[model samples]
Target: MDYSYSEHKQCYVALDCIIFGFDRKDLKLLLIKRNFEPRKGDWSLMGGFLESDESLDEAASRILSSLTGLKDIYLEQLKGFGKVDRDPVARTISVAYYALINLNDHDKNLLPEFGAKWFPIDELPNLIFDHEEMVSLAKARLRHKASNQPVGFELLPDTFTLPELQQLYEAIYETSLDKRNFRRRILSMNVLEKTDKKQKKYSKKGAYLYKFDEDKYSEQKNKNGGTKMMFKPPKV
Candidate 1:
C-alpha cells in the first residue's frame, strides 16, 4: 500500500534536547557551538532531524547520545515548537525534550569533539532562534518536576550528603533554603537511606552520606495514593 497526502504541505521535523547537569553547586545547561551553516559558531541546543525509523523520544535520545556519549539518561518531552518563521533555513517544527545527567558521569572527552560546553543556567549566552525560550520552558519544567517527584536525583551523584542535596535544590530553584527546615522536611519523607559514610569535602566534622531509596519511595508513594513530594520553604 502507498501512502499519499500530496494535497498537504510537507515540512521538516527536528528534535531539540535541553541537556541539564548539576555540578554540586549550580545547575548547568549543555550547549553546542554550531559549526555548520544557518548560524555557524553560535551556541545552540544539541538537536537533530527526526528520522523515519525512530520515534520522537528515540530521536531525542539519539541526538543526546551523539553529542554527550551518554546512554540511559533521564529524558522528558517538553513541548512542540512550530512557528511559521521559527527556522530561518527551512520550514521545520522542532519537538523539545529536556534531559538530566549527572555531571560526573558523562563522557568528558566527547564534549570537545562536538564543541559542547556547560553554561551556568543563570549566565547563559544568547541562543539562536527561540532556543532561549526552549531553555526557559525546560527550566520551569525541571523545577516543577523536581518538586513533585524525585527526579532531581538524576542530577546528583549516586551517594550524596544532605548539604549536597540541599544545594541541588537551591540551584534548581535559584533561591536559598533554610538548612534546618529543609533537612527536616527531606528526612521526614523517609526516602533517603543513610550510609555509613561521610563526605569530608565541605566541613571539618563531615556530613553523613545518603542515597535515594527508590523502593521505599515507591512504596511510600503508593501508600499515600500518589502524593507529590514537594519542597516547602520555611516561613520567615
Candidate 2:
C-alpha cells in the first residue's frame, strides 16, 4: 500500500560539524561537550537543527559560527547518519560536514567557553554516539585530500618552512617522510613562494620559509587536476 505525502511522518535534520585543525606537528579535531540532556557532558561534534527556512549549508555555517566564531570555512558534506536510535532524545537524521580550520588563527577562547575543546586525532577519548566513526572517516578524507591538494597549508600560518610543511603531512600520515623527496615535490609545484625568513627555533640550519601562491596553486589545480605529494610510509 502506498502512503500519500500527507501520511508521511515529519522528521528533523541536524548538521554536525567535524572541524579539523593542523598546528605544525599534530592534527586536532574540535569537539563539544553536550550541555543539554540525553548525553550531557559527553564529547560530541558541534551540531544544530536545520532551520525551516535555511539550507543545510546555511545551518552548518550557523552552527559552526555559533560555536567557534569562525566564518567562510572550507566544508564538505559527509554521509547522513540516521539509525533511528542514533539520538535517544528524539529521531534525528544528522548530516555531517567536515571542515578545515587554521588553529593558529582561530580564537582559542571562543570554543572552550561553549563547552568545546580541540583534541588531537590520535589522542581522542571516547565520544558519544557514532562520533568516533565520523572522526575516522574524516581522517581518511584528510589523508586522501592532503596528497592531492595543498591541504596541509590550510592548518598552517600564511608563511612556513619546508620542514614545518613536512611535519604537517607526517602528522596526518602518522609516519615520518623522506625530507628530500617531500621538498622536491613541493618545490616542483611552483606554487610556493620561498621567503627570505628562516625558522631557526627547530633547527640550527635555520630552514627557509615559504608561502602558498594562491593564484598559481589554483591554476595548477585546474590545469593538472591537482599536485600530488606522495610519501610512502615506512614498512612495518
lDDT of 1 at 141: 87
lDDT of 1 by residue, 1-236 (tens): 99989989999999999999999999999999999889999999999999999999899999999887888989999999999899999999999999999999998999999899999999999999989999999988888887789999999999999999999999888888988989998999999999999999877999999999999899999999996565664322
Candidate 2, pairs of clashing residues: none
**What is candidate 2's lDDT per residue for 1-236, written digit by digit as tens?**
98679877888898888999987878889989889887788889988899899999999999888876888878888889999988887888999999988887777778768888888888987888888888888888878877767666778898988888888888888888888987887788788998888989977989888998989888876787656444343432
Give RMSD (Å) of candidate 2 vs. truth: 2.9
Per-prediction CA RMSD (Å): 1.8, 2.9
What does candidate 1 score in Cα RMSD to the true structure?
A: 1.8
